[model samples]
Target: MKRQFAVIGLGRFGGSVCCALIEQGMEVLAIDQDEARVNKYRDLVTHAVVADATDEQALKHLGIRNFEHVIIAIGDNIQASILTTLILDELGVEHITVKAQNDYHEKVLTKIGAERIVHPERDMGVRLAHHLLSKNVLDYLELSDKHSIIEIIASTKMSGKTLMKLDVRAKFGCNVMAIKRGREIIVSPQATQLIKEEDILIVIGADEDIKRFEHEMFDE
Candidate 1:
Protein backbone atom coordinates (compact mmCIF):
# COMPACT_ATOMS: atom_id res chain seq x y z
CA MET A 1 0.00 0.00 0.00
CA LYS A 2 1.20 3.51 -0.76
CA ARG A 3 1.84 5.68 2.28
CA GLN A 4 0.56 9.26 2.46
CA PHE A 5 2.74 12.02 3.87
CA ALA A 6 2.33 15.74 4.56
CA VAL A 7 5.52 17.83 4.62
CA ILE A 8 5.17 21.29 6.18
CA GLY A 9 7.78 23.96 5.41
CA LEU A 10 9.24 23.94 1.89
CA GLY A 11 12.77 24.89 2.77
CA ARG A 12 15.68 22.79 1.53
CA PHE A 13 15.22 20.09 4.14
CA GLY A 14 11.47 19.79 3.72
CA GLY A 15 11.74 20.06 -0.07
CA SER A 16 14.27 17.25 -0.16
CA VAL A 17 12.00 15.07 1.99
CA CYS A 18 9.05 15.84 -0.26
CA CYS A 19 11.01 14.91 -3.38
CA ALA A 20 12.37 11.72 -1.87
CA LEU A 21 8.94 10.56 -0.76
CA ILE A 22 7.55 11.31 -4.19
CA GLU A 23 10.38 9.35 -5.79
CA GLN A 24 9.51 6.39 -3.55
CA GLY A 25 5.93 6.43 -4.95
CA MET A 26 4.36 7.98 -1.88
CA GLU A 27 1.60 10.58 -2.01
CA VAL A 28 2.93 13.86 -0.60
CA LEU A 29 1.16 17.09 0.32
CA ALA A 30 3.80 19.81 0.33
CA ILE A 31 2.94 22.87 2.38
CA ASP A 32 4.80 26.12 2.93
CA GLN A 33 4.23 29.79 3.59
CA ASP A 34 6.57 30.76 0.75
CA GLU A 35 4.78 31.11 -2.56
CA ALA A 36 7.97 30.59 -4.55
CA ARG A 37 8.81 27.29 -2.85
CA VAL A 38 5.29 25.95 -3.23
CA ASN A 39 5.23 26.96 -6.89
CA LYS A 40 8.55 25.23 -7.46
CA TYR A 41 7.23 21.88 -6.18
CA ARG A 42 3.68 22.28 -7.46
CA ASP A 43 4.07 19.63 -10.14
CA LEU A 44 6.51 17.51 -8.14
CA VAL A 45 4.21 16.45 -5.33
CA THR A 46 0.67 15.11 -5.27
CA HIS A 47 -0.41 18.47 -3.83
CA ALA A 48 1.45 21.71 -3.08
CA VAL A 49 -0.09 24.62 -1.19
CA VAL A 50 1.05 27.84 0.46
CA ALA A 51 -0.30 28.08 3.99
CA ASP A 52 0.60 28.81 7.58
CA ALA A 53 1.38 25.38 9.02
CA THR A 54 1.06 26.68 12.55
CA ASP A 55 -2.65 27.34 11.96
CA GLU A 56 -4.72 24.33 12.98
CA GLN A 57 -7.66 25.43 10.79
CA ALA A 58 -5.47 25.55 7.68
CA LEU A 59 -4.10 22.09 8.47
CA LYS A 60 -7.56 20.58 9.00
CA HIS A 61 -8.90 22.20 5.83
CA LEU A 62 -6.09 20.47 3.92
CA GLY A 63 -7.03 17.09 5.44
CA ILE A 64 -3.66 16.70 7.09
CA ARG A 65 -5.13 14.26 9.59
CA ASN A 66 -5.63 11.76 6.78
CA PHE A 67 -1.91 11.50 6.16
CA GLU A 68 -0.14 8.51 7.67
CA HIS A 69 2.82 10.69 8.58
CA VAL A 70 3.55 14.39 8.92
CA ILE A 71 7.02 15.91 8.70
CA ILE A 72 7.67 19.32 10.29
CA ALA A 73 10.76 20.67 8.55
CA ILE A 74 10.41 24.35 9.44
CA GLY A 75 13.92 25.77 9.53
CA ASP A 76 15.01 28.47 12.01
CA ASN A 77 11.51 28.88 13.45
CA ILE A 78 11.22 27.06 16.71
CA GLN A 79 7.87 28.65 17.51
CA ALA A 80 6.38 27.60 14.20
CA SER A 81 7.76 24.10 14.42
CA ILE A 82 6.50 23.66 17.96
CA LEU A 83 3.05 25.01 17.15
CA THR A 84 2.72 22.81 14.07
CA THR A 85 3.72 19.73 16.02
CA LEU A 86 1.26 20.53 18.77
CA ILE A 87 -1.57 20.99 16.30
CA LEU A 88 -0.70 17.74 14.52
CA ASP A 89 -0.72 15.86 17.78
CA GLU A 90 -4.06 17.42 18.75
CA LEU A 91 -5.49 16.32 15.39
CA GLY A 92 -4.32 12.77 16.11
CA VAL A 93 -1.85 12.43 13.26
CA GLU A 94 -0.45 8.89 13.52
CA HIS A 95 3.23 9.74 13.14
CA ILE A 96 5.11 13.01 13.33
CA THR A 97 8.76 13.56 12.48
CA VAL A 98 10.49 16.87 13.15
CA LYS A 99 13.80 18.41 12.18
CA ALA A 100 15.30 20.12 15.21
CA GLN A 101 18.02 22.75 15.18
CA ASN A 102 19.65 21.80 18.44
CA ASP A 103 19.41 19.63 21.54
CA TYR A 104 17.01 22.05 23.20
CA HIS A 105 14.72 22.00 20.19
CA GLU A 106 14.84 18.23 20.10
CA LYS A 107 13.87 17.97 23.76
CA VAL A 108 10.98 20.38 23.27
CA LEU A 109 9.69 18.40 20.27
CA THR A 110 10.01 15.16 22.19
CA LYS A 111 8.05 16.59 25.10
CA ILE A 112 5.33 17.62 22.66
CA GLY A 113 5.03 14.00 21.40
CA ALA A 114 7.04 14.14 18.17
CA GLU A 115 7.62 10.52 17.13
CA ARG A 116 11.11 11.18 15.72
CA ILE A 117 13.55 14.09 15.63
CA VAL A 118 16.48 14.55 13.30
CA HIS A 119 19.44 16.92 13.42
CA PRO A 120 20.78 16.70 9.89
CA GLU A 121 23.54 19.25 10.29
CA ARG A 122 24.84 17.71 13.50
CA ASP A 123 24.76 14.21 11.98
CA MET A 124 26.61 15.30 8.84
CA GLY A 125 29.18 17.10 10.95
CA VAL A 126 29.87 13.94 12.93
CA ARG A 127 30.27 11.84 9.78
CA LEU A 128 32.65 14.31 8.19
CA ALA A 129 34.68 14.78 11.36
CA HIS A 130 35.08 11.03 11.82
CA HIS A 131 36.25 10.53 8.23
CA LEU A 132 38.73 13.42 8.50
CA LEU A 133 40.20 12.21 11.80
CA SER A 134 40.82 8.65 10.61
CA LYS A 135 42.54 8.00 7.30
CA ASN A 136 40.91 4.58 6.87
CA VAL A 137 37.47 5.58 8.09
CA LEU A 138 35.20 6.04 5.09
CA ASP A 139 31.89 6.53 6.91
CA TYR A 140 30.43 6.47 10.38
CA LEU A 141 26.78 6.03 11.42
CA GLU A 142 25.76 6.41 15.00
CA LEU A 143 23.32 3.66 16.04
CA SER A 144 23.21 4.82 19.62
CA ASP A 145 25.42 6.70 22.06
CA LYS A 146 27.51 3.54 22.58
CA HIS A 147 27.21 1.67 19.26
CA SER A 148 27.89 2.48 15.61
CA ILE A 149 28.38 0.99 12.18
CA ILE A 150 31.45 2.11 10.26
CA GLU A 151 32.98 1.62 6.85
CA ILE A 152 36.75 1.41 6.93
CA ILE A 153 39.24 0.95 4.15
CA ALA A 154 41.27 -2.23 4.55
CA SER A 155 44.91 -1.28 5.14
CA THR A 156 48.37 -2.93 4.78
CA LYS A 157 48.16 -4.36 8.28
CA MET A 158 45.05 -6.26 7.26
CA SER A 159 46.21 -7.24 3.76
CA GLY A 160 46.68 -10.98 3.27
CA LYS A 161 45.10 -11.63 6.67
CA THR A 162 41.86 -13.59 6.98
CA LEU A 163 39.04 -12.79 9.41
CA MET A 164 40.08 -15.76 11.55
CA LYS A 165 43.72 -14.69 11.44
CA LEU A 166 42.88 -11.19 12.60
CA ASP A 167 40.35 -12.49 15.14
CA VAL A 168 38.52 -9.15 14.97
CA ARG A 169 35.64 -10.46 17.05
CA ALA A 170 37.98 -11.60 19.80
CA LYS A 171 40.63 -8.93 19.62
CA PHE A 172 38.63 -5.78 18.85
CA GLY A 173 35.09 -6.94 19.67
CA CYS A 174 33.89 -5.70 16.30
CA ASN A 175 32.16 -7.69 13.56
CA VAL A 176 33.20 -7.30 9.96
CA MET A 177 29.75 -7.75 8.47
CA ALA A 178 30.55 -7.17 4.84
CA ILE A 179 33.29 -6.26 2.39
CA LYS A 180 32.86 -3.96 -0.60
CA ARG A 181 35.20 -3.63 -3.58
CA GLY A 182 34.30 -1.41 -6.47
CA ARG A 183 30.70 -2.34 -7.26
CA GLU A 184 30.69 -5.75 -5.59
CA ILE A 185 29.61 -6.31 -2.01
CA ILE A 186 30.20 -9.49 0.00
CA VAL A 187 27.84 -10.12 2.89
CA SER A 188 29.06 -12.11 5.86
CA PRO A 189 32.59 -12.22 4.52
CA GLN A 190 34.10 -15.69 5.12
CA ALA A 191 36.59 -16.25 7.91
CA THR A 192 39.10 -17.45 5.32
CA GLN A 193 38.57 -14.59 2.86
CA LEU A 194 41.88 -12.72 2.91
CA ILE A 195 41.57 -8.97 3.50
CA LYS A 196 43.03 -6.90 0.69
CA GLU A 197 44.16 -3.30 0.53
CA GLU A 198 41.42 -0.91 -0.61
CA ASP A 199 38.59 -3.26 0.35
CA ILE A 200 35.90 -1.40 2.31
CA LEU A 201 34.89 -3.29 5.42
CA ILE A 202 31.47 -2.66 6.88
CA VAL A 203 31.84 -3.17 10.59
CA ILE A 204 29.37 -3.01 13.50
CA GLY A 205 30.24 -2.94 17.15
CA ALA A 206 30.31 -0.90 20.33
CA ASP A 207 31.54 2.65 19.81
CA GLU A 208 34.69 2.20 21.88
CA ASP A 209 35.58 -1.06 20.14
CA ILE A 210 35.08 0.46 16.70
CA LYS A 211 37.45 3.31 17.63
CA ARG A 212 39.99 0.85 19.02
CA PHE A 213 39.83 -1.31 15.91
CA GLU A 214 40.29 1.67 13.61
CA HIS A 215 43.28 2.91 15.57
CA GLU A 216 44.92 -0.53 15.87
CA MET A 217 44.16 -2.08 12.44
CA PHE A 218 45.01 0.87 10.23
CA ASP A 219 48.27 2.82 10.03
CA GLU A 220 47.83 6.57 10.32
Candidate 2:
Protein backbone atom coordinates (compact mmCIF):
# COMPACT_ATOMS: atom_id res chain seq x y z
CA MET A 1 0.00 0.00 0.00
CA LYS A 2 1.10 3.58 -0.59
CA ARG A 3 2.37 5.40 2.47
CA GLN A 4 -0.15 7.78 3.99
CA PHE A 5 0.67 11.45 4.59
CA ALA A 6 -0.85 14.56 6.18
CA VAL A 7 -0.39 18.26 5.44
CA ILE A 8 -1.24 20.91 8.05
CA GLY A 9 -2.05 24.53 7.17
CA LEU A 10 -3.78 25.01 3.84
CA GLY A 11 -1.87 28.07 2.72
CA ARG A 12 -0.05 28.41 -0.59
CA PHE A 13 2.89 26.15 0.19
CA GLY A 14 0.87 23.50 1.98
CA GLY A 15 -1.82 23.53 -0.71
CA SER A 16 0.79 23.07 -3.44
CA VAL A 17 2.42 20.19 -1.57
CA CYS A 18 -0.92 18.51 -1.01
CA CYS A 19 -1.83 18.84 -4.69
CA ALA A 20 1.49 17.44 -5.84
CA LEU A 21 1.31 14.54 -3.39
CA ILE A 22 -2.23 13.69 -4.50
CA GLU A 23 -1.17 13.90 -8.15
CA GLN A 24 1.60 11.40 -7.35
CA GLY A 25 -1.03 8.91 -6.13
CA MET A 26 -0.27 9.25 -2.44
CA GLU A 27 -2.95 9.14 0.26
CA VAL A 28 -2.83 12.70 1.55
CA LEU A 29 -4.94 14.27 4.30
CA ALA A 30 -5.13 18.04 4.00
CA ILE A 31 -5.76 19.88 7.26
CA ASP A 32 -6.38 23.52 8.03
CA GLN A 33 -8.21 25.67 10.56
CA ASP A 34 -9.95 27.76 7.95
CA GLU A 35 -13.13 26.09 6.66
CA ALA A 36 -12.97 27.96 3.35
CA ARG A 37 -9.41 26.81 2.65
CA VAL A 38 -10.28 23.22 3.58
CA ASN A 39 -13.34 23.29 1.33
CA LYS A 40 -11.30 24.62 -1.57
CA TYR A 41 -9.32 21.35 -1.78
CA ARG A 42 -12.19 19.10 -0.64
CA ASP A 43 -12.14 17.05 -3.82
CA LEU A 44 -8.41 17.17 -4.50
CA VAL A 45 -7.11 15.05 -1.63
CA THR A 46 -8.12 11.84 0.08
CA HIS A 47 -9.31 13.85 3.10
CA ALA A 48 -9.68 17.50 4.01
CA VAL A 49 -10.18 18.40 7.69
CA VAL A 50 -10.95 21.68 9.37
CA ALA A 51 -9.07 21.60 12.66
CA ASP A 52 -6.59 23.63 14.66
CA ALA A 53 -3.07 22.28 14.17
CA THR A 54 -2.11 23.66 17.57
CA ASP A 55 -4.76 21.59 19.28
CA GLU A 56 -3.20 18.34 20.45
CA GLN A 57 -6.55 16.61 20.91
CA ALA A 58 -7.61 17.44 17.36
CA LEU A 59 -4.38 16.01 15.89
CA LYS A 60 -4.70 12.85 17.96
CA HIS A 61 -8.25 12.38 16.77
CA LEU A 62 -7.04 12.51 13.16
CA GLY A 63 -4.34 9.92 13.99
CA ILE A 64 -1.65 12.33 12.84
CA ARG A 65 1.10 10.17 14.34
CA ASN A 66 0.03 7.21 12.21
CA PHE A 67 0.83 8.96 8.93
CA GLU A 68 4.22 8.18 7.42
CA HIS A 69 4.90 11.86 7.00
CA VAL A 70 3.26 15.10 8.07
CA ILE A 71 4.15 18.53 6.69
CA ILE A 72 3.65 21.70 8.71
CA ALA A 73 3.24 24.62 6.33
CA ILE A 74 1.86 27.23 8.66
CA GLY A 75 2.11 30.75 7.27
CA ASP A 76 3.82 33.71 8.99
CA ASN A 77 2.78 32.63 12.46
CA ILE A 78 6.20 31.55 13.65
CA GLN A 79 5.09 30.67 17.20
CA ALA A 80 2.17 28.52 16.05
CA SER A 81 4.33 26.83 13.50
CA ILE A 82 6.98 25.99 16.06
CA LEU A 83 4.42 24.83 18.62
CA THR A 84 2.77 22.56 16.07
CA THR A 85 6.13 21.05 15.15
CA LEU A 86 6.95 20.61 18.84
CA ILE A 87 3.62 18.90 19.39
CA LEU A 88 4.24 16.59 16.45
CA ASP A 89 7.63 15.76 17.82
CA GLU A 90 6.14 15.01 21.23
CA LEU A 91 3.54 12.80 19.58
CA GLY A 92 6.28 10.83 17.85
CA VAL A 93 5.22 11.54 14.29
CA GLU A 94 7.28 9.41 11.91
CA HIS A 95 8.56 12.30 9.83
CA ILE A 96 7.94 16.00 10.11
CA THR A 97 8.68 18.47 7.33
CA VAL A 98 8.04 22.10 8.20
CA LYS A 99 8.16 25.28 6.16
CA ALA A 100 10.32 28.00 7.67
CA GLN A 101 9.33 31.61 7.24
CA ASN A 102 12.90 32.90 7.60
CA ASP A 103 16.35 32.06 8.92
CA TYR A 104 15.29 32.46 12.52
CA HIS A 105 12.26 30.25 11.98
CA GLU A 106 14.44 27.60 10.37
CA LYS A 107 16.77 27.61 13.35
CA VAL A 108 13.87 27.08 15.72
CA LEU A 109 12.44 24.29 13.60
CA THR A 110 15.83 22.64 13.55
CA LYS A 111 16.10 22.92 17.31
CA ILE A 112 12.65 21.33 17.66
CA GLY A 113 13.79 18.24 15.75
CA ALA A 114 12.04 18.86 12.44
CA GLU A 115 13.13 16.15 10.00
CA ARG A 116 13.13 18.54 7.04
CA ILE A 117 12.67 22.28 6.56
CA VAL A 118 11.86 24.03 3.31
CA HIS A 119 12.25 27.67 2.33
CA PRO A 120 9.92 27.61 -0.66
CA GLU A 121 9.81 31.33 -1.29
CA ARG A 122 13.60 31.68 -1.26
CA ASP A 123 14.11 28.67 -3.53
CA MET A 124 11.52 29.94 -6.03
CA GLY A 125 13.34 33.28 -6.17
CA VAL A 126 16.55 31.51 -7.14
CA ARG A 127 14.76 29.58 -9.88
CA LEU A 128 13.13 32.75 -11.21
CA ALA A 129 16.49 34.54 -11.48
CA HIS A 130 17.80 31.78 -13.76
CA HIS A 131 14.65 31.86 -15.91
CA LEU A 132 14.96 35.58 -16.48
CA LEU A 133 18.44 35.08 -17.85
CA SER A 134 17.33 32.61 -20.55
CA LYS A 135 14.10 31.79 -22.31
CA ASN A 136 15.08 28.19 -23.09
CA VAL A 137 15.40 27.31 -19.42
CA LEU A 138 12.16 25.48 -18.92
CA ASP A 139 12.89 24.50 -15.32
CA TYR A 140 15.72 24.43 -12.79
CA LEU A 141 16.30 22.12 -9.84
CA GLU A 142 19.16 22.51 -7.41
CA LEU A 143 20.79 19.22 -6.55
CA SER A 144 23.34 20.77 -4.23
CA ASP A 145 24.97 24.08 -3.44
CA LYS A 146 27.07 23.92 -6.62
CA HIS A 147 25.21 21.39 -8.80
CA SER A 148 21.85 21.48 -10.55
CA ILE A 149 19.59 19.70 -13.02
CA ILE A 150 18.03 21.93 -15.65
CA GLU A 151 15.63 21.47 -18.53
CA ILE A 152 15.97 23.32 -21.81
CA ILE A 153 14.29 23.23 -25.18
CA ALA A 154 16.64 21.94 -27.89
CA SER A 155 17.42 24.91 -30.15
CA THR A 156 17.43 24.98 -33.96
CA LYS A 157 21.23 25.21 -33.84
CA MET A 158 21.36 21.92 -31.98
CA SER A 159 18.58 20.14 -33.87
CA GLY A 160 20.87 17.78 -35.78
CA LYS A 161 23.87 17.42 -33.48
CA THR A 162 24.34 13.91 -32.14
CA LEU A 163 25.48 13.35 -28.55
CA MET A 164 28.88 12.35 -29.97
CA LYS A 165 29.09 15.54 -32.02
CA LEU A 166 28.06 17.98 -29.29
CA ASP A 167 29.98 16.07 -26.60
CA VAL A 168 28.52 18.11 -23.76
CA ARG A 169 30.26 15.94 -21.18
CA ALA A 170 33.67 16.43 -22.71
CA LYS A 171 33.24 20.11 -23.68
CA PHE A 172 30.87 21.63 -21.15
CA GLY A 173 31.30 19.14 -18.29
CA CYS A 174 27.57 18.42 -18.12
CA ASN A 175 25.57 15.26 -18.75
CA VAL A 176 22.36 15.05 -20.72
CA MET A 177 20.51 12.54 -18.58
CA ALA A 178 17.51 12.33 -20.86
CA ILE A 179 15.70 13.83 -23.83
CA LYS A 180 11.94 14.38 -24.04
CA ARG A 181 10.58 14.33 -27.57
CA GLY A 182 6.87 15.06 -27.68
CA ARG A 183 5.36 12.33 -25.52
CA GLU A 184 8.37 10.02 -25.51
CA ILE A 185 11.39 10.18 -23.24
CA ILE A 186 14.83 8.83 -24.21
CA VAL A 187 16.78 8.21 -21.01
CA SER A 188 20.49 7.46 -20.84
CA PRO A 189 20.66 8.18 -24.54
CA GLN A 190 23.41 6.56 -26.57
CA ALA A 191 26.15 8.71 -28.04
CA THR A 192 24.75 8.14 -31.52
CA GLN A 193 21.39 9.63 -30.49
CA LEU A 194 20.74 12.96 -32.17
CA ILE A 195 19.03 16.07 -30.89
CA LYS A 196 15.77 17.19 -32.47
CA GLU A 197 14.13 20.59 -32.56
CA GLU A 198 11.55 21.19 -29.79
CA ASP A 199 12.99 18.28 -27.78
CA ILE A 200 13.61 18.95 -24.08
CA LEU A 201 17.02 18.09 -22.66
CA ILE A 202 17.34 17.27 -18.97
CA VAL A 203 20.94 18.06 -18.11
CA ILE A 204 22.82 17.81 -14.83
CA GLY A 205 26.20 19.19 -13.74
CA ALA A 206 27.94 21.79 -11.62
CA ASP A 207 26.26 25.20 -11.72
CA GLU A 208 29.22 26.88 -13.41
CA ASP A 209 29.49 24.18 -16.09
CA ILE A 210 25.74 24.47 -16.79
CA LYS A 211 26.08 28.25 -17.16
CA ARG A 212 28.94 27.75 -19.63
CA PHE A 213 26.92 25.17 -21.57
CA GLU A 214 23.91 27.49 -21.79
CA HIS A 215 25.91 30.52 -22.92
CA GLU A 216 28.11 28.65 -25.43
CA MET A 217 25.71 26.05 -26.84
CA PHE A 218 22.07 26.82 -26.14
CA ASP A 219 21.99 30.62 -26.02
CA GLU A 220 24.73 31.43 -28.51
C-alpha local distance difference test of each model: 0.94, 0.93
How good is model 2 by TM-score?
Answer: 0.88
Q: In order, what is each prediction's RMSD in angstroms?
A: 1.4, 2.1
List of clashing residue pairs for candidate 2 = none
Q: Give the least accurate 10-residue stretch of model 1, judged by summed lDDT.
A: 211-220
For each candidate, what TM-score against the reference? 0.94, 0.88
After superposition, the stretches of candidate 2 with alpha carbons farther than 4 Å from their true spots are none
Task: Tell me the lDDT of model 1 at 187.
Answer: 97
lDDT of 2: 0.93
